[model samples]
Structures are given as C-alpha cells and as structure tokens.
Target: MKQFFLTLAGVFAGLVLFVIVTPIALIALAAAGSSAPATSPNTVLELDLREGLTDQPPTNPFAAFGGAELSVIEVVDALDRAGDDRNVKAVLIRLPEMGMTPAAADEVRQAVRRFRASGKPVIAHSQGFLPVGAVMSSYMVGASASELWMQNTSSFQATGFAADEVFLGDAFGRYGVTADFEQRYEYKNAVNTFTESDFTPAHREAMLSWMRSIYDSALANAAADRRQTPAAMRQAIESGPHSAEQAMALKLVDKIGQVEEAEAEAKRRAGRNAQLVSVADYVSNHGLQPGSGSDAIAIVNAEGAIVTGRDAGGGFGSGSTIYSDDTAAAIYEAIENRAVKAIVIRVSSPGGSPDASEQILAAVRAAKAAGKPVVVSMGTYAASGGYWISSEASAIVAQPSTLTGSIGVFGGKFVLTEALGRFGVDLRGLSVGGEYADAFSPTGRFEGQDRAAFAASIDRTYDQFIARVATGRRLPEARVREIARGRVWTGAQARELGLVDELGGLHEAIARAKALAEIPADRSVRLIRYPTQKSPFEALSEAFGVSAEGAQALVAVGGVLASPEAQGVIARARTEQLRARGASVLADQPVR
Candidate 1:
C-alpha cells in the first residue's frame, strides 16, 4: 500500500512537470521559427483605434493571449515605422465609438499628422460617431486624419463637456453613516463627495477652470485642423447631435458610407489592387521592440496609480496599478544598460501612495545621476502622486488637455458604526497600545484630538510635497506653494505657470529626449521598451495540457474577467476610487 501511494505521488509530480514544460517548449519553438515581417508594394496599413485605448502595453504578456489593444505608444511607434516604409502606400484608420481622455486623443492625432507629413494619405472612418457610451475624443482623432468618413446610420455626437460629481453625504446620512475626513487645504476636496451634499465654491471653481480649459483647447485644435475658426467650432458644437446628412452639410464629415465604402476609397487612393494589412498582424510579424543592440532610448511606461513594492498586474483592487519598486527597477535597468542613452517616463496616474511616489521619484533622480537624461510624458491625468514622481524629471511634456497638478494631501476613514446599528448590527472598538490606535477605525468617529493630529500629518506631507517640487523645478518655495493649494491645472495652464516644460504628446517627448541625449536629428534610434514583458507560457504555467487552442480559451477567460468590463466598472465608481493600503498622501482629481 505504501509503495502504491509513493507511485501515485511520482505520477502527480511528473504530470505537473509536463504541464509546465510542454507549453513553454512549444512557445519557444514557435518564437524561434518566427521570421521578419515583410510588406508588399502598394499595401495599405489598417490601424484600428476602435479596439479601445490603453495608456501602456499589457503588464502581463500572457494577459494579452486572446487579443489586445495596442497601447497609445505602440500605435505611435507603428505610424513612425510605416511612415518610412517604401512599400506602404497609405494608412486606413478606424476611429469608432470609444472612450479616450483628451490627452490620448491629442497624442494619437499627433501621430496621424506625422504620418501625413511623410506624404502618405491617411483616411479615418467611424461606424457610428458618438454612439452611446462614447466621447468626442473619437471625433477629434478622426478630424486629424487626411479625410474623415462617417457611416450613414451615424451622427455627430460632439456633445461638449460637463464636470459632475456624485455626493454621497445625504445618502450616507440617511443610514447614519458619518465620514471623518480632513484635508490640508480647501482645494483638497476629495473627501467632500462623502461629506458634502453639493460642491463647495472652491470645488466648483476648480472643476470649471480645468474643464473649460480642456474644452477650449480641443475646440480650437479641431477648428484649426478643419480650416475653421474657434467661434465657428463653438457654434457647430452647440448645434451638435447632427445626423449624417447634417454632418456632411456642415463639412464635419467628408463622405457618408459603410465600412466597405471607406475601404474601397482607401484602396483606390493606394492604387489598384491595394491590399489592407492590419496593424496587429504587421506588428506581430515585425515586432515592436528595438531590433538593434545599438544606442537606444527606453520608453518606461508608468500608468495607473503609484504604489510601493513591485507590481504583479491584474488582481483585486489593483487594476492598472503601477508599483514604484517595479518602476524603479526598470529605470535602473535602463541606466545600467550601456545600449540605452535616454529614457522617457510615460506617466498617466491620479496619484495614490506618497511613499510609493517618493520611491519612483528617487529612482528618477538616480537615473539623472547615472548620466541618463530622463523626460516625463504626461498623459490624461498625472495629478498628485503622479506629479510627485514627475517633478524631478529633466523636463516634462504634456498634451494641452492633460490634467496635472494638485499638490496637497487628504486622508481619513468613514465611521459606519451608526449606519450598521440601524441595520441591526453592533460593532465595538478596543485598542490598548497606541494613543491614536483608533484613529482609522470605522467603528468609531474621529475625536477632536484625532482630527487635529490627522490634519497636522496632512499639513506636513503637503509641505514636503511643495518643497520637493520647488527644489526639482528650480522655482522659489513661495512660487511652488502658490500653485500647490491642491488645485488642478490643465497642461496648457501648467505650461503657462512653468509647471510643465512643453505642450506636446509622446512623439514630441521622444524628440525632446533625443535632443537632450545629443542624438542627431536625422539619426533614427531604436525605441527600447522597459522591463521585458512576459508571454502566455509564463502566465498559464500551472495549467495542465494547454495547447495553443487551450491557451486561447484560457486567455479569453482571463481577458473577460480582467479587461473592459472590470475596468469600466472601476472607472464609473467615482466616489470609491480603489487604492492600496496606507494611501494617505492621495493626490487625484475629483470624479468627472
């Protein structure tokens, strides 16, 4: 009987080994057999922005097993490559109904314009312009294309912008819930959603300022592209919710047709018998990483909230989170590598843990100390802890619509004992060692002393934040403090205030990094991606007998659980933004 048990154990161990080894070996063989992608003459490149946008590439390579949306940076890199390719005759883009932060819209638009500069005709189309749950960002990107086409069933959905908030104060009060929170300054209104029924004067003022700034810039840029004035753009926008025929009449859409019609037009422009090559297929064949081992500029993408420790992507309460330790390691790796000459830190975050922000900030400083020039390319929102890590960069670049700045701190916890009591639940709190042990306990409310202590802590952190910015940006302490009242600023305003170095997108940020690194303007340097992303074999290592087919099935499951559906739910949870433990130094804008 003991011998039989031992034999069973051996068989189990062997099966486990087979499960891990077989799939990896197969993936390795496939990768080894892969060849360079080839482009045929008169081929039209098809780029689809409809797959939705991601600030950066997949943190878990195996996470993209089913299919993937190319990160904004990846899209720009493809355009750069396709622009110079001799066989690529033109480009076709799909800008369907999608959600994009204004900054992302601008960056992709910039890439499309760059492609046009290469004398390649680029056409953009939409299945339904401004469909339900989409944004005007899609239309702005379409406008940047050489020509824009809309479907017959589509309509102009450039509904303009409005800032809104969901106040939970009254709702919580009805249930006897009380929030015990405080901020260092008036502009730090993050906790107000739970404490106030309506926006305070200060909160209303800040939202209007930034929203107006974003809307105006987007309006002006759209008009400029279409050869119209800002006033004309404003007038058209006010008359929005236009039908397909109205869009054509207003010159907002060039042609009204179906997907087939759009493709036929692109093929005609590319010459007879032109074939369409998908961006995904072309990238898969060619790869996105720098092929050469020579001088390179690493693109260190830092998206989502900043937290301490290394990152292991896609887990509960940690979707799209950026771990400072992982970011630091990537920076150090770039610095230590002799092949890398410069680094671009692409940051798109709303700030979370201050300690994590500091960790990333220290790493950026170290890179500069190691003779590696660093540039920060800000995306949709890089306020608070996001701004904290970016303050120390060699220079900062942002799109005109990027929301940045918010140098203040706010922290506390809600007391739900009363609310729970109404629901026939009783709770008690007991603490022995520390005087402030019950400070964060949800069973109790903040006592006067506890509130004061928490406020003081926030004040100290705010001061430290301001001092760091002043030192890094070479501005006076008073000047930094002037802008550090927990106020948000648009990228255009930040640039005007000297908070940002320039107003541009990732492409321009790369140009600035190249210039700072002393790389010649005409020289083409390979873009090195950081941290070396992983693959399917690594992700599904523990699964049994998983073939390529099995891998796809598993990937689909993982993607569904972790992709758009989960992200959308979190995005809509304005009042309860998820963060790591000890996120007291929270820096982020109020829900829009």
Candidate 2:
C-alpha cells in the first residue's frame, strides 16, 4: 500500500510540474517576441551561401532556442526587401565564409546584382580560405560590387575541379556481401561505388566531361565579371593558390582588408554611416508585408526524401534523415492552404517507397486541381521517385549539373540461407495454407513463381511511372519510354530530352512559378511552411528521453530488448533504412 501511494505521488508530481511549466514556457515565448529590434541606423545585410543552395527552407530548432540560422528563401527574401529599404545602406556578399553550392551561390549572386542595380552599393568580401567553387562564384558577383575585399592573412585554395568517388567492392567481398545489381546502361553508375573499385570507363568519361563543362562555364562567368581572362584564372589555379596579397597583385581582389575594413568601404560607397544588420534581422524588421500586395507566390520546400511519418531532427538537421509521412502531410497541407497562391515544389531526393511517392504525388495533383500552379525546382539529385513526384508540376527547372531521370523500380529481399546454415541452425516450419506463405522468410531465395510475380509488379510500377511522366510532361508515351530506361542524365540533357522544361536553379524556378500563377514580378510573396508548429516544451521533450516511452515499450513487448539502449538504437537504424531507401530518389551517391 505504501509503494502504491509512492507511485501515485510520483505521477501527481509529474502532472503538476507539466502544468506549471507549460504556462511559463508560453509566457517566455511571448516575451521573446517583444525583444525584436525596433530599428537599426546602418544596416548592411550579409548573405552567406555556404551549404549548397537548398530549394526548401531549413527548420532550425536551435534558432528557436535563440540561435540565428536563416533559411535559404528567407535570406533571399530579406535581400530583396533590403534593396528598397532606405535605412539599409549596403549589402555584403559573404560566400567564402559559407561554402555554398553553385546553384545556391548563384541565387545570392543574382540577389546581390539586383541590390546593386537598385543604386545601393554592394561590397563583396572573402576570407582567402575558400573552395574553388565558392571563390569563383563570389568573384562573379563581386564584379558588380563597388569594392571587393579579401582578408590579409587569407589565401585561396583553388584546386581545379575534381569529383571523387569511393568504391567498397573489396570491402563488401571481405564481408561476404554480394552486391548483385543490374542496370540498363553503362552511364548508370548509381551502384558502381558498391560494386567496383573505380569508375567504369564510361562513367569516368561522362563525369569528367560534365565537370569540365561546369568548371569552364563558371570560370568564364567569373572572368567576365572580374575583368580577368579565363586563361589567367586557369593558369593561377593550375600553378598554385595565391595569398591575399598575391591575389591583389594579380588583380583578383580589389583590396586587402578584414571584415571591418570591408564594412568601412561599404559605408563610404553608400555615403552613409548606418548600423549594420544581418540578413535575418533585416527581414524580421520588415515584417511579412508583400512587395506590392497585388498577388502572392507560395514556396513549398520538399527537402529530403518523401517519407510516411513524422520524425523530428530527421529532415535537414545534422544527422537528419527522411520521414516520408511527415513530408507527404506537409505537402498536402501546403496545397490546402488558401493563402498559398502558387506552389513551388523544390525536390532533392533520390527516391524511396512507392507508397510514399504516390502519397506526395497525390498532394501535388490536388494542388494543381485547385487552379494553383505547381513548379518543380530540382536540386543536385532528383532522380527515381524524386522524378516521380515532380512529373505533375506545371514546369520543372534544373541546374546544368542536376542528376535526374532514373526511371526504374527495384525491390528484393536479401536471403541469408547460407549465413544461417553456418550458424548450425536447422529451421523447420509447418505448411501454411497458401503457396506463397514463406514469401518473406530469409532462409530461402525467391523461387520462379515469386520472382515472376515480383517482376510483374515492378513492370506495372514502371509502366505507371512512365505514364505519369508522359502525362505530366505532355509527352508521348513512346517517347517517355525511350527516355525512361533506367538511365540518368545531367539537367542539360534532361532539358533536351523534355524531362525538364528549362535549365536553371531554384530562383529561376520560383520566378517561373510566379509567372505561371499570374503574379506580377514585383508583387510580394511569403513562403508558408507546413507541419504545424511544436512548442518548445514538446521539442525539448522529444530531444531528451521524455517522449520515447512508447518506442521503448514497443521494443520491450516485442522481446527485442537486448539492452536499455537497444530500443533507441533499433529505432534509429530502422529510421535510417527508411531514409536510405526513400532518399535514393534525390541522392547521387547511395546514403553512406
């Protein structure tokens, strides 16, 4: 009786604590809202494009906890607004500090160019230690800047472009894991990393040509912007990276200075001494008013794989993975929101389950049925099911290097008959009613009938995939099949093949989406993210050990509780497996 009373007391204590903390948390959040900066005297918005460009807005839980990490779209929107704000003196292009992808960097570059065009002087500065791509992109935008500065102590690390692939064939062999995979063409090197020691001749040739084309184009653009010959830039990169002093001597940088010195130069050019504001602060201050209030555009970011359920910290954060259900629901909600004028579906997935892909595609169709334009912006890898969901978009945009159009489905079970035999395990089972009763057992390989059924299912899925593509792209069915033979293509190739309508990045896709939605180019649009907000307490409970009791209970009930930590480990492992399978649609290399 005393022990029962103690248990009851513990439950009561927990309930009381929850009630007390909930109101305090809400009050604290309310107080946080009041701390927004009223105004700034001198604001030079700094745009950092470090983590390759993303089509979807990032969710930063840390930001909710008081750190500031701007979403990609948020940064772009702020820069656009800052160009017209009278209090905003100048803008700074800080790409070197943030290693951004060519596409993402291009978005910022375009924004900076627009800001400069608005008669606001833009200053571009870099700390010399930057990747070749970042340096080249920054140079392109800094060309339009009133001044370009590099840190005195910094030096360039402009190693000419190279793409590296790690092969695990030998390791797999050592582990007795056979990677029996099939592909339709030599250019399909998706499975090569796991099956071969190095790139096949065809793979090497294609990748080399693609890289050369991208690097050459980038160099040409940078040369034109910085007023340096491509040949000179090529020579400098081939020889060695240059110090900031050497770069200035070579006319690569306008001046040698630190961030503060660059800020002073920006102030002098703007002819105003004003307080400097970050891109995040500037946007918050401007509020969510539209540019002209005529019409609005909605940006719906679909980053990561399309999964079937919700999993926090598993979308785009560090150690993140895909949650298909969460993604599908988010897309569905975005489609139903009345305030969302048009939908821009930004995809960066490899592919995953057919069910999850269909779920997301259904939402896409619903969005289109509502007379809202849906435009797809493809990121680095949007092949397989990534291509599946994108087929319904009114317009599709891809970058030159975007890897897309892997139109195939593969499914099989790994039979561990030999491994189990080695364990001295003799398994016997009673006959089930159906012939396919043992279909999922690991003890045996799939027989002729099972294989035939599986093949038929795959064929049906492939046909549906082809039909979807044909209808969505407005292409003939035969033509779709011609391009859908499990082959991958660069964005440029896909555009020529009609898989993509245009060759551009996310910003261009957004522009096209707005045009399709009949929104004037000058009108304001705010991106509304789906997935209802979770309170800080809920977030914290999820982060710690507070909310995982159900998972623990499930594992224990299943008699799989080898240890206290086993439940979490198993949950993570299963989550990763789902992510790997689903993310295959957008990923270039398999998930590591």
Candidate 3:
C-alpha cells in the first residue's frame, strides 16, 4: 500500500519530467536547425576534438544528456567544405589527450590533406601524444598535421600497438562454471576466453600478425609524413617517454608551445586578423538537406553490433547496435525510393550475428538488382559480420587504419551446474523431445551427437561467410578460404590483399557510388540519411520505454545500492540475460 503509492507517484513524476524536458530539447534542436551559419572575414576553421568523435552521432534525445560529440562524417565533410571556402584561410586542429580510433584519425587526416591541397596551412596543437596501451590509434591522428605543436609540459609515449584478451576459464572454474564450446576452425578462438586459460595457437598467431601489420603501417606512414626513414622513426618511437622539449629535439614535433601560440601562428600564416570558426557550427549550416536534389545518394549508417530481427537497442548509452531488420529495411527502402540514385553503407562495426549479416547482405544484393549501386564505407572496423555485409557491396572504401577481415564462426553455451550448486542453487534438466533438446541447458553439457551437430552448424556458417566474400569480392573461393580463418587486417593491408578496392573514407565511398551509377562529378546529389530519422517525440518514447523499467528498479534500490560499481554489476547481469536469449552476435569485437 504505502510502497505501491510511492512507486506510482515516482512513475508519474518521471513521466511528467520526461514530458517537460523533451519539448525544450526539441525546440532547441529546431532553433539550431533554423539558424544560419555565421560569417566572418579570413576564417580559420577550429577543430577542437575534446568533444570526442563517433562513426555516427547518436540521435539528440540520447546525446542531449552528454557533451557534444561529432560524427566522423561531419568532421570530414566540414573540413572538405572549408577547403573550397574563400573566407576560410587556414585550419586548426586540437587533439584531445583522451584519444580517438586510428580509422577516425585517418579520416580527419585525409580531410586535412584535402584542405592543405588548397594551399592553406593546417596546424595541430595537443597537450600530449598518448601512445600508451593501444594509444597508437590516437597518435596516428595527431601526427597527420604538417606542423604539430605540443604543450611545453606534455609528454610523448609512442609504445606502438598490441592486442590483449582476457581468459576466464580458470577464473570461472574456481566458481564451478564450465564453458562447453567448440569452434569450426582453429582461427575461431572467440570461445577461448571461456574454454581455455590463454590464447590458442591460432588466436595467438592471428593477433600477432595483425598487430605487427598495423605497427609497420603506422611506422611507414609516420616516416613518410615526417620525412624520416622507417628505421629512424621506429627508433624515435621506441625512445619515447620524452618531454615536450625532447620531442621537439627528436623532430617528433615542430615546436613546444601553448595553444594560443599555435593560433597566433595560424593567424600569422593567414596574413593576420583571421577569425576562428568552429567546424561544428560550419558543418551544421552546410549539412545536406533531405529531398533537395533531383538525384539522391542514400547514407545508410550500419554502426554497432549487428543483430537479427527488429532494432532491440542495447549497449551502454544506446551508442552501438545494428538491427538486421532495420538495416535491411533501410536498404530496401532506399531501393524502392525512385529519388535515391546510389547507396553508401557506412559500416563501423566489429561484427555481430552471422544470420543478421546474411539478412543485411541480402538487402544489399536486392538493391543492386533494383539498379542502385551500393558502396561500403568502412570506419574504425568492419570485421566478421561487419565484413560479411560489406562483402557484397559494389565496392568497399576503408581508411588505412580500418580493421577488416575475420571471416569465422564460433558458438556454444556455458555449463554452470557446478557453479550454481556452489551458490546453493541446484538445477536438473529434463528433455523428452529430441537428442539435442538439452544441448543449450546450463544444467548439462553437450554429448557426442549434440557436440557434432553444433560443430556442423558453425562449419556451415563459416562456409557461408567465405562464399559471400568470394562472390562479393570476385575472388577465388580458395583465396577467400585462405583469408577466412578469422584473420583481421587494416585497410591498408586489406587493399593489398584485395579485400577492399580503395583506401579512403565516407566521401570516397560517395564518390565511388556516384561513379558506379555514372553520375557526373560536378552534379549535385542529395545525401539522404536512410532508415529515416525518427522525430524527437518518437525517439524520446523509444528511449523511455526501452530503459524505463531498469531506471525504475535503479530508483527503487537507491537506498541499498549506489555507485557505478553497483550499476556495473547490474549491467553484467543484463549482459548474461542477453546472452541467454542469444542476443549478442559472434563478430562482436572486444573494444580495443
């Protein structure tokens, strides 16, 4: 009674607060949408990346709670536009100490490269160059500028690249949990974390191969940019933990100075009195208006973990997810729309479900058959199922750091009867239907026949994945298989191996799509965002409905539980729930 009334009152208050907050946000976005870009004489486009970057900016309802983060596309397009603006005399990029993906860094570098082609100077200012713990990606982005200025007090730590994976088999065993799993091939070592104590031979080999390749690629590019030999570059990086003065002495950076000093240098180069323009503000003004042109290039964002059926959102902050039905429907919708001339599938996934990949690939083929040329634009990654869906595109464009490849399959369930028993919970399984009916039961392990069936399924899925790559890439099946053993490759290496046709970004993909469809280079095409953006109201409803129960539970347990660690425990339980329902996909890459 008292509790019921309290809960009811809480719900009502939440609803009212949500209703009140939503409209204010909508009105702000509306005002933002209507506002024109401010003009200034002798503009220097200021790109401060402290806001962070994403492959696709989350819709505002989710984003409003956080600080501003721009999409890679937005950043790149803005720079590209600034290249042609007469008023824009130079560019200033401020690299965040926190870091960004190598692929994103490469994209921004490409944009700067283009802007520099206009004979305008590009300068970079950073507090530090963080190359600690896979910060290689971040380092790659900062070094792209012609002149890099580091703060006098900052440090440079360029330790190069490595892949780290955690093994929980022994840890789980301590708790009496057993992972009953098998892989189709040796390369499919995703289950090793649960079934083995350390990396399998195949997993070790694959990780080493890709890590070395990335390291070498970075070394080569940095050498080329700095006019140093690869050998010298490697020596300099290995000799790191250098102070700003030491970094300058080592020729790693042009100078050690404050941000204001860097800005003064830009103004000096731009003939003085140059105004600074925020790239974000500029891009918003030049952003593509849907249905504005006679012909359209559909940009269908395929970010996050790809899953089957309709979009059932997951991931912390709803930051990542690619629903099979939603993606396929978006592709099909683009195909059906007479106005859309070409399609570009911008993929920034580490892979997901094999079935979901196939479904999305089917839609890509359907669009091609319907006469719309499809191009795949790879972001930070497009591996496993990410590569699966991309395999059938008319062409694939990827940044030099974009991680692709990894065609393999692995699946099974954890047998936790002993673990549960240790917790004073015992379970019994009864199945009268079929031999493999209890195969997925945590109370039991798979028998010989059930194990064989599961292996066969993985084998079949792997074969299908290989076949798609073979057909889409027009490579021999043998070659596809040769590369199919769950191998990851950077875009620079992938192109050499014939995995991607071009080493580029979203703009390159758009250009390729236009070329494939025979659209003239000078002709304008509407970049229509596909899968249709939802209204703020609809997005708010979705956000509230999806997480409302969890949010309420959080409130109810406020007294007993607190802090993010407590929240993390709850989140892990949610992940286990998702796993039990087979929600997470196989190609889901661990965050680098």
What Cα-based lDDT does every candidate model obtain? 0.78, 0.65, 0.78
- Write the residue-wise lDDT of candidate 1 on 200-259 in tens digits: 998998888988887788778778888889898788877988998888898887888887
In model 3, pairs of residues that clash are none
Q: How would you encode candidate 3's per-residue C-alpha lDDT over 190-275 as one tens digit per residue?
A: 78888788887888887787677667766777777778898988898888878989888988889889999999998877765788
The global Cα lDDT (0 to 1) of model 2 is 0.65
Q: TM-score for every candidate vs. truth? A: 0.84, 0.75, 0.85
Stretches of candidate 2 above 4 Å error? 1-32, 35-38, 48-55, 59-68, 97-99, 129-146, 182-188, 228-236, 270-273, 283-295, 310-341, 411-447, 487-490, 503-507, 519-592
Per-residue lDDT of model 2, residues 1-592, tens digit only: 5544554465354333334333444444454355555556566666654433444444433332332255455666677777777777788776454234545445555566677778887778787645543345445556556677888898866545655788987776665445544444456577777779888887787677556655665677666667678898677655657888877777767888888888777766655566666665565555433444535555555666666766754121333234667766666676667777787777777777667788788888887898888888887568888899899889999876566888877655544555455577665555677767776566565677866666677778888888899999999999988767777676767888888998776668878988998877877666554554444444435544455454234323334333446545644554465454443223323212
In model 3, where is the ten-residue run with the lowest total lDDT?
583-592
> Which run of 10 residues does model 2 get worst, by summed lDDT?
583-592
Candidate 2 TM-score, true structure as reference: 0.75
Segments in model 1 whose C-alpha atoms lie over 4 Å from true places: 1-33, 65-68, 131-134, 289-293, 312-318, 541-592
Tell me which of candidates 1 and 2 scores higher on lDDT: 1
Q: Each model's number of backbone clashes?
A: 0, 28, 0
Model 3: number of backbone collisions:
0
